[model samples]
Target: MDTTVSVSAEPEKKPPTLFERLLINRNYAFMWVGMATSRLGNVVFDTALLLWVATTLARNAPWSAFAVGALIFIPQIVALLMGTFAGVLVDRWDKRRTLLWMDGARIFIVLALIPASGLFHLPFPSGSDIATFFQMGCAFFILILLGCCDPFVNPALLILLYDIVPEDDLPRAFGRGQVLNNLGTIVGPPLAAGIFFTLGIQWCIFFNAASFLVSFLNFMLIRPERNAQKEEVKAEQGAKEEKKAGFVHELVEGLRFVGGNGVLIAVGVSLSLIALGAGGLNTLNLFFATDNLHATPDIYVYLDVLYGIGAIIGALTVGPWVQKKLGVMSGFCIPGIVTGLLLFTYARLDNVYAGFIVLFFVGVSQATFYVSFGPLLLKVTPRKLIGRANAVIGQLSTFAGMISIGLASVLVTSPLHNKHLTLPGFTLGPIDTIFMVVGLLALTSGIQAMATFNDYKLVDKQEETPAEKSSENEDVSQPLISYVGRPGWLSTKKRQAAICLVGFLVCLLIILPVAFIAPSSTAATVTMSYGHPATGETIEGMECASTVATRQQLRTHLTLYVNGHMAALPTGIGIVSPKQPGVRALASNGNLYCLYPLHVFEADNIIHADLPDTRTYTLGQFFSVWGQPLSRTQIADYKADAGKQLKFVVFDGKGNEINYTGDPGALSLEEHKTIVVLYNSPDVHPTPFTDWNGL
Candidate 1:
């Protein structure tokens, strides 16, 4: 075997201007447009679905927040496996057709959502309290399926772009692609919100499906000549001999290639770490809005818009400019540093306005990173190997995301003895921890980029044909091993079971505390009386009590009073009580009276007596021995039941009443006690109730 690298002759022609260049290259433009359109549709659909799940469908579920994470992570996990097979198929078959099929499949899958929405109208399965579960479940399943297919779609498109674009134009092509991608970021969220508001979430899915169909049609229009030539050459050469291999082998080959190429390896690892940090921060943004910023649901759109505007700026300005002026590594590094600093500063910001400013910069940095890296990766990879290379890089990045998720999950939810002290002033929720982690990773990636600036020079110039072919084999070597090893942690069975168990336990733990501490204290009262208007006769009785009892206790206590006979009266005569109480005491001359406390748990108790006769009962009827004279207002309202007496008992921490009935659900025992002390305490209020009933 010849080991020496061979060089291809350099072309002797000047490159066209960027605009002219893109217009002349139909393949690059088509792929760029298709990818951008597809991505926009995806974001719109995903944002809509997420909003629906969070606000309408799974809104009440304990695991609602986890649904979003599952949507992101499940697809990534599937992508790792499917992406490898997709790479193999793209290499072995027509790349354009592979992409076409992927897009077509996505269109159909999203269209299926139209019927799935019908499930929402179905009578919920009997015994289920949360009816939206089945509908949301269907959505989740569809999203997972989409995730499975996405790996093939992304890599195939990238490889196709590499196949059609000349080496020198690759960076600008990718930069333009990044601009289009950022344009998607700009359009997606607001479009989704608008569609969701006006047309409902189902229509967003339909629109996304339509976008996929359009992208598929565009893919079909692209010429397949270059892909066909590459496949024909490979077919003539026959299958390259391999030392026995599996998925792990292919995966490792990709890993090894990335590892061997210092520039590629640094880029991959740095970006992975950066993703770990940035993804965690993004994950916590919603929580930050609600918890820290005190934002309601409606405000999220404005927040998203702020971030989107920054992303647009980065994509349109920083992204293309950096790709042209600085090498990709420097472009990535600059943004990485800026984003890190901004994120770190965000941690210090207590005001929501400040957070918005920081997040905007964060969005810009993220856009810069994406645009800069895409072209850099394409520059190092051969056209034929781009699919596998991306698969491997994607797998690593996904793995990094998974790790970040796990870490953030632990940091956010884990109970710490000194949680308040762990991060001073800021209530360190899961999001706070995630932001800190992401910031550190970004700083590390930025520093690493600065350290490895020299290595990127090797990627500036294209190699000769023989040497390029050799590098392709080298690039593929590590990925082969990564593909076969099937990283132990990525096992679907283990991950699913573990996630379910942990989620279940977390739900149980969170619910238990709420169940223990969430009942409201109630205070209610009722009154009844018996008297004759023509004769000066009256009979009135009153009792006051309070209990920290359950609802059953309150019901039973009221029932007993309502059922008991007073002055030989029938049980249903004229008992007046709250809904929890029942009826028994007699009524006469349009007057009603019954025994009840003015306060139930924590309320003021008032007592009054009056006869139905043309005469008003004096306070002496109830508290005749009291020395203080009753106020005229109090005298007019007082009423007495014939041959009945009134007595007052303090329940202390229990509901109590005087002359007036308490408002239902008025106050807790603590509040009543505070009010009572404030009103009656000699030190605070010199005027006290002269007589409990007369006051």
Candidate 2:
């Protein structure tokens, strides 16, 4: 007889909800709090910056808005170019330390913007040409330095998030982070606007600096050692490759892994294309609100608040709901199409409130997409190759953004600014056209995603258990597998290297135009005024000085040429022509002078070549460079046939004057001298500009 007892099977435990997990997880809680606080500061800083540029500085000069955008995006352009290499470094460094130091560095860098404000002439002098340009340039440099910190900071954060969060709880971890980020978005703008209106942009910047410190301290408190076992596993795996792969080879290995994965490539590529459309929105949304919707600053703030609210709700509800209903792939595809429609509708709405409503839903769609996409990214990418996979996606998206911003710059600044396009049956403005194009692209991406869904249906198939997948290299001959486990371009390390080299060149091509073609301002300046010395109606304001400085510092003389006559005093085209183009170039648009601060071109008021030590310029070369006409019979529009003779004169700072009695072109530009040309108005003897020392 057998005395056998039947044992009951233990019930399976259900996973905790996102909120429940956050409540119990200490490290995740710290990261969430730190990110939320810092994000609040970022939103406030961005709002303050936009208000300062739009309402305060570029309100009247809308084109100057492009300059403001260039300042912000130029750094992003640089960061994208270097992001891949930076990711390689992150894979080898202590992620926690890297994040902490970067935040610390940001605090000091942000504080510097205050002092820079003094140099850039903040509170924006109404008529100072050099002040606004110089300020924009200063803002650019500050943001550029800030941007350098991101490539390191972001990748480290990505790595750390994976390091600390349990795989099953990751969806909740990311969702909670998104909710907090959106919370910052909701509260930050209004707070920034309040601070900007009450204290100033400086205080808003100060708030951001302080927030960085908060994040830094929180980062210090986080105990990443809870994930020590996982880290050990990674270390052991890394040790295996130590004997075979060098840095480049290791990077190539990651590339080969990603290249062999079809789902990652498809997601990365589609997102990149969609990002191009999103660029126009980022670059032009503020302008659209202010210019097209006729919205006030308060309305703009309100619209953003609405968007934030919707985003928070969506992050909490929509993401999970979509995944449950449509599965991962289908959920991702549906949102893109809906988001496109919402965005397109937003562009066409004339009523601000209607726009506010539409943009809220747009935010919902975006948050949902992000939530779903984040998990998909983590699911498919291998632990060892996660950094490079993310780097590849980031680089592609950034490259798209760079292209879009460049295109936006061209469209916004050219005839497209306010010009309307007459299509076959309807008329659309340039901005509207941009919206339509972006909308169609997003919609097309969604349709393509639907068609591609079947290709990845088996991605979630459990043919292999998690352990089996983890032991993916058991087949050493094909350590990394393609969709069909077939060898392709990434079959060899050499092929992977070739792909990486080509990718690097592509990045270079994308960044070149942003660096070279975008309008970059300088801090060096020159005070300028134009008009008759009698009434003395001068163009008040310092001009943006040229970025190019003199090879060897030297002062120069000026001698104006006209018709064929000489006068007794100096005045005309350039009142403050420095010996160097460094400061001068700042004030020139091509060869034409800008009514600085104003950005208006004064074609007649231009400086030609640098002052010569001994060689003289024919008054004709001046006209050629100035895009004007100078001849024996006519000086400018003034004609010699009308009983009028051109007069040219030279003067020293001390009022000592010499009447030139030769061809106007023959006069010498001696050092420390002033030249003037009186065209047909010989009776009007202009006073020499004696403020050379002040310049």
Candidate 3:
């Protein structure tokens, strides 16, 4: 009797859902609460600030539009001036501390604004032209201070989110965040209006400060970790690299990268045109409603409320549904098209109710477009340049918006001021006419965006299985036997085996001579697999790189816990920038930089194994690429604290921690096998590296 064994495939495990992470996760909870509280506060504060400028400081002034518009314009100016260096700074700063500092600084600034703006009720007489100008100056200064905080705040939020949540959950988290922000926009403006009219500007300032204080406290409570001062000492090499590539160099590099990439340029163009229209709309929408629609100012405010509600719906439902159906590009492109149509319709509509409905859809489309941008940015951006890229991308929109606001102010003051054009059926004034022009610009942007979005397809399509991929690869090589059809061409098992042998022999015949004749100069380094080494062979500092796409690039997760807190992995392991003098490394094309086979792209746990050939890489080899010492007694320059033990543990894919007895560096790095090094804690339970999260 012959018996056959059946093999069953294990079902793939999914990452914890967003709700699960929200309920159980402490780190994420703190971040979410803090972000939610502050975001609403920021909107309220902004609305109040603008109201104060318009109603109090710039009241009855002939150049009141310029006074109010300058406040809006200053931030964009600051971003253009300071964003590049700030991006690099955020990359190096501690993520938690960055959040704390951003909030803390704003709290003080707002508090000072209360006194500086004379909102606290000055003893002297009020409402003089000089007094009004002083108050405006104070408000402008506060805006400048807040603008400086943005470069740190925005990039840190994204970076910290990367640390707090798994990679797969990022899109969901960001989507929810967008919804929360839209809700804030809906609620904040009304609240601010009430407080400004009833409680006074001082009260608004107080509320803003209180909100920031709450955020600061939450940041203080987030994931307690020991930040040893010696970490600075350990990162000396990285610091030296930073010093070599100073702010000016990085600024130039950022400009070059953003300007050179076609995708980013296309994206920038799309965003700029849309922003131009939005800014112009913001500047003139009130006049459009009051004059064109003959609506009360209070009733026109519902336009924003309706827009915010629609945005929330789009972010939560429409955005994801569309992205699933037609990919992330469609989430952006489709929304852009819809938004353009809505803008044009909004301009033509004379009924107030119709205006609200049209603006609501406009908000939906705009929010969907913004929500989709995060994923698309991640898709195109290199891991090494995320911080710098984030800083610069926003400036593109800001640049366009600032210019539009300035130009909008000019158009109304010039000969075109309120010049109503009468047609057979419609009468168009400067405000509505400008909006119509803005609509045309939006339409052009949408068309341009669609042109760039042509190649991307449905995002929800199922991924190909490994077996299917193998069959496809085989089909490319073998001509005799068709795997797709006619499987019975070789019926007997013997005939199948014979055919396989022939194909294998044919592959070898074609490949063997090319392998022997392949140029040694193709790579500047030799392949050194784990457990096999030639005598006196050394791959010390900056010695190994293939300089071309390899057959496979493996990854291993390496985590370190110092006194029970997770440690941050330092960046720039394999890279050797050419600008650094006295650094001996091979010059590549354009003599820009060189790389090692084993290196890390950023400050993450994933260690990239990009050697010349496919083989098992060891933990020791990784440390060698890092140019750092690794052993039971030491990690880089770190040693066990007094009375503490250093334990090295390897966790398999299933999260089972296994302690091995041997040289720590000799341990082989299997795919997603987390190599954990714990210092100063012997009794604590090992926290497994859960998932690489598709990294």
Candidate 4:
């Protein structure tokens, strides 16, 4: 028997998943996990800190909120000041050790703040403007200390990455690092919001402190073995020789390397301008969230959440395409333009939901610009000069940001602080004015970036058509007509990227307005007849739920009527009121009053809202808008102290009365319908509407 020997085809190899690919390297995987843990802490700390400043502390002095924001950025300014020197120092040190020590130091520093915050409040009179400023000062000092760690930590981390990963894997390693960072960003805000609203600011800070410890532990576990130690020694020896070359000499060498590079100069200038605009916008976002959008702490968290998601999308999907399709410089220009337009749109939008969409797109554009710019900077610079080039860019951007924030603080607080300004050409609020200026700056930066792209310098021009394909051949070296050529169609990679970029933006444009844009004229009528023992006076009008007054003012009024009952837990929801401390805390000073989009108890005695759609809204939502609780046992403190249970009777437009107890807050309202919230005895029932003429 003749036996034919056959070899089976090799089993197909499956591509590694993102996590698998990232974690394949033992060191990077540990660092990434640590980074994620650290990010969660940062998010929680930031949210709690901001809420503490914006709501808990700076409730009276709104400007102090800006001060809190400005103080947080103070560390970035410090980085700009010391970044070059710090880079030089970082190169001399063992990066892994440096990272470990820095993380350990930060954990202790953050932990110390919990006690420090309380201690700082001791000397200052509580609930006073002075106390607010004192609190802000404490925050500023803490942030400066935190900021000081970044320059050391950031460069060390970068160096460690180079030391651990092979040259071929650097890009993948950095990409993984960024993905984890964004992942932290996306999850942190909402988590912080949940904890802040429930467990309070202390828990948030504690969590953040713990995160740093986790990161430190992960760094401790990174073992690069003998090769890493050797590289570190080599680096230190090189650094020592470079030191003998003199600091000025080394600085000049790096600067000279960048001097001839046109792309670096263009990117630096463009980014500086963009940073200035961004700084102004960033300064205003918190205020805009509370003041303009009338958002509570929970809603403000969405801004960070949505932006993080958009950034992730941009980084993973859209950014690569945009960067490839548009040359790096041109790509920067596109995001700048789009960002400017989106900011303008954001300034105009009145709805919080719409604002979320605008912020999301803005985030996408920013992410694209950042990812594209970094690679280009790295690609063009000599390895030796890279640190200095980055430092220069960082300093310039920081300087611009500082100037813009200072200017914005002044403009928004005093000089241009007005609800509306009737200038010769335009009319807008002080916030809107800042937004307009920033938008224009971004646009200008985009134009400047676009102008910097040249075929001979950075971008490769498409080869000239062969003589056979040309209409006619010019005589050898005749002076060609100098015509500026537009960039040719992008490569297939870029085209695909562009499609993804446009897809997100287009989807945002179509979906948001359709879902949230309400008819300006379609008003809803809300009538509230609430009083103990049948006072019979109906409190109606837009004032009850109108979000016209400042949040502080609305909250003050909300506290007066809703009182302690607002924070009480729903009885029928399988829990008792005051059982969970978190629920109890949420009821008090949680910005719950801001939930009311319209003032239901205005002098008009009828809450009028231009709703997006005609869907029936629950009475609970109405109570939420009124800054009151609606549950089985309570309705805005009505007879709650008297130990009386709450009840409700609802009449539809057709005079069909529906009586319900144990949380009738879910009851729906209709045109010309009547809802009576009764406490204790039900002797005085609500009369049904016989005529619909009064609606």
lDDT at 166, model 3: 57
Q: Candidates' lDDT values, in order?
A: 0.53, 0.60, 0.64, 0.59
At residue 35, what lDDT does model 3 achieve? 85
Candidate 3, residue 679: lDDT: 78
Measured over all alpha carbons after superposition, the RMSD of each candidate to the real structure, in angstroms, is 16.6, 14.8, 36.0, 14.9
Model 2 lDDT at residue 570: 19
lDDT of 3 by residue, 611-641 (tens): 5656667888777765567787887756765
Please, what are the lDDT tens digits per residue for candidate 2 over residues 1-695?
A: 13332222223455767666554477777777778778898888877877776544443343654754675577788787767778879989999999898889999988888864542434432223455566656677777888788889877988788887777878667656667777887899889978876677789889999999999988898888555679788888788866665778767876776666666666675587578777777777666665445455555687888888888877778878999887777777777888878877876765678888988898888778777786776667656666678867877888887787777666665645434433466445555556665666566556555544544443442555777656736432232323433355444334433443453454344334334443321111222223221111232222333221112112223333333233211122332232232232222223332221112121112122232122443444433333345555555445676576656676753346877776655554333345666656555555443212111
- Residue range 371-453, candidate 4, lDDT tens digits: 88887776566445667888678777878888878877766655444334333664455565567667766765665556555
- Given candidate 1, what's the lDDT at residue 268? 71
lDDT of 4 at 487: 56
* lDDT rank order: 3, 2, 4, 1
Model 1, range 365-477, lDDT digits (tens) per residue?
88888878777777766555575677677767778887666555444443321132222343343344345546666766666655555423533334346676566344443
- Name the 10 consecutive residues with the lowest summed lDDT in model 3: 520-529
Candidate 4: misplaced stretches above 4 Å?
1-20, 116-125, 228-244, 256-260, 379-383, 422-427, 454-456, 459-695
- By TM-score, the candidates rank as 2, 4, 1, 3
Q: Where does candidate 1 have its weakest 10-residue lDDT segment? A: 551-560
The reply for model 2, stretches above 4 Å from the true place, is: 1-29, 81-96, 118-126, 158-171, 223-231, 243-265, 375-387, 422-427, 454-456, 472-695
Task: Look at candidate 3 and give me any clashing residue pairs.
Answer: none
